[model samples]
Target: MALRVAAELRRGQVVNLGIGLPTLVANYTPPDAGVIFHSENGILGYGPHAAEGEEDLDLINARGEHVTLPPGGAVVSHTDAFAMVRSGRLDVAVLGALQVSEKGDLANWMTPEKGIGSPGGALDMAAGAKRLIVITEHTNGGAPKVLKECSYPLTAAGRVDLIVTDLAVMEVTGDGLLLKEVAPGWSVESVRGLTGAPLRVSDGLKEMDFTLPQHPPVNKVYPSAAEAVADVPDGAVMLMDGFGGLGGMPHYLMLALRDQGAKGLTVVSNTVGIARVSGFGTPPSPDLQAVDHSILVERGQIRKAIATFPVSPSPSRPSAFERAYRRGEVELEVVSQGTLAERLRAGGSGVAAFYTPTGVGTVVAEGKEVREFNGRQHLLEEAIRGDFAFVRAHKADTLGNLVYRGTSRNFNLVMAAAAAVTIAEVDEIVEPGVLDPEAIVTPGIHVRRVVQRPAVFSPFQPIKPIEDNGRG
Candidate 1:
């Protein structure tokens, strides 16, 4: 049915599809068909639905799923969007129907069973478009919908040009409803048995084709980390993943973010900043401008930090974030290490919040809901999602599939899936099928952009175990 609807759309046509069933048409429209989809929400030529777990809260369709704009797509204001509708720019408007009459009357706004109805842009599209096509079921709960007169409230009278249903396809003419084609296994006599209006069977009537079509694959590679995070705005919640200092840190991306200068950021990380010890972790790169999230804090770009460890293990060597906090320069939300990882995982999985016993009885239980499971009290921890994720990986395919080495996999894998845009900096960029499928830590669907880290900097190496001397 979706293929049949897509066949009606011509190349270079601007189309508006109503909510619900009409939205499915966009999914099935062939990528090369050149049909531009315009949404009442103000985006024209938006790309397909976002890959799961990579939903950007800001860019969305009417259904509230995150989306993107094509290379030539335009994002207009709400007023300008309505202008496109009312100014006769739309060539076709395909909508779902509650009931359509023989005389081309459309009743799709509401039914008698429901009191409230949304007239959102449907009224405008119906009244303004050159052609209107209705897609719906033949019957509403086993009742006829192609009626002599519609029983539901009318959206537009004498406007519907075509109707496609589960039973048959009909064209509205000045005389009556003309049956152009019938669904498979459905005959003219059986269709007439279900219609309230008289049917005029076409001399060349045929069967509707239900062949499925394939959706196009998208390429998600960006040239540089700066360009990858170029669109990130101020006041964005960012997830930065690293453990044991620079081993798994997104060093170059953080440097790019600091240079990008988007202020008032709320960074969510396992640790607020990277801490270097005399003989542990990876040594800092001298040529690099900054090494960790502390660079952003030192530059005063971050407004708040939600972290598991905000201070260094060594009391004498305070990190930049601890200094900022001590001076009342930035806000902090302290979360337990386990709870923080779970929160990020939950956030990406669409869970709002969960209860945990890690922070219970401490200050973390202050204003949160405390639930008793059995006898122990648990504190509710809200999920931690972000606008952008800065991830470090050993390698990435052009499609953004990431593979990590050793400890680099910590937090990096989960953080990649927990943000709207996961910008990855990797040591190498390989083509598809070059990396082992089983070695893929995070699939390409969850990543938005991938940039190759320069070879000048070395990969993080782990500290070797110290041997004991028997001098004591």
Candidate 2:
């Protein structure tokens, strides 16, 4: 199967090898091949397997387990990693799968069999990449892994473009699956017979010309505080910013950290919402309890959360109920929105404390110093810091200047400027000196990495005219 699979590798491709099956590709990438491997945890260079005591403690791939960085390899935060993927900086993303439908839909995130099927980075990779290459076993339990159609749950709707199995290589097309190449000893029909699902054939099905994936370093365009804290040792305090999915790339990077199983993360954000898009213009009221990645952290899966605010979900959803049931483990400390913003700002400004009336008489005042000024009481909140900050903006110029769009500007701009390392994810990457200087929101000084994501999903929230209220 390795021999059959190695042929699909092409030199100079930025590749994402999936966790289980796809990770194997890292071991197989040819030494002479120049393909760069991107781990979601923010590493961009990889070398062959290491000899004893040769591996650097800092070099690691997206999965967060220790890995070796090839010569000229660099490390950034997960926010920077996804920036590369979303910006179309990568040539190919090799993902693993539970099933591949005739229509090329991938259902690898969760099987009915697995308890917690966090889609994690798969959703981002599937939707953001220009080309997605999935590598998986032909079948699970003698049932074909390829299917007439996916009966399991879908991770991203209709995203996969190519599939390489032990027996053959097939491409997804608008009409159906197209058989592109077959192993030397395997017949198309033989490959089809072993597949538990229906198969499609292309008019030009043939053997793939074997080659290694390519890797070429595009110059770094964005510079941020990441360079400032590059010397921070691994396993130090790391804080990220995002109100979960809608906010920006921070949550994406947080998931990458969770996957890496990196401990001692002192996450300080407004709120950790559900895995997918939970809140964004649902009327800023705080009744929503999003099922954040903290769900994993609370179960002793990761470390404890040291920030304020509990998961607030929207009305009438089962996930909200599940979150409530698990509230005991969450150990949340709720804070007012204004206070959260100020606290983060203070952290970035290197301020020890800030006075705010937002949480004065409420439960939020349980701990800390309280003082009366002009007959009004105020509680003091301390500053916070982390090894990194994952942020996404709408656009970036070649010099790493950034501009955010609409509600996308929320928490993102502040977090972008606040973190030790700010990674910007933009939908478009233009040449230097192109954007109007006035339109630039976050200056190039705050942004460390700028990657353009052409097809990053920004759903249209149709604006409706407000009907007249009785008060009006």
Pick the TM-score winner: 1
lDDT of 1 by residue, 319-359 (tens): 88888899999999988889989888776655578888887
Global Cα lDDT for candidate 2: 0.61
- State the local distance difference test value for candidate 1: 0.78
The sequence of per-residue lDDT tens digits that candidate 2 reaches over residues 117-208 is 87888877887666888888777777888887788888766788878887788888887777878877888889988875556777787875
Give the per-residue Cα lDDT of candidate 2 at 79. Answer: 70
Sliding window of 10 residues with minimal summed lDDT for model 1: 463-472
Residue 348 accuracy (lDDT) in model 2: 56
Q: Model 1, 113: alpha-carbon shift in Å?
A: 21
> In terms of TM-score, how similar is model 1 to the real structure?
0.58
lDDT of 2 at 410: 65
Instruction: Specify the poorest-scoring 10-residue window by lDDT in model 2.
Output: 463-472
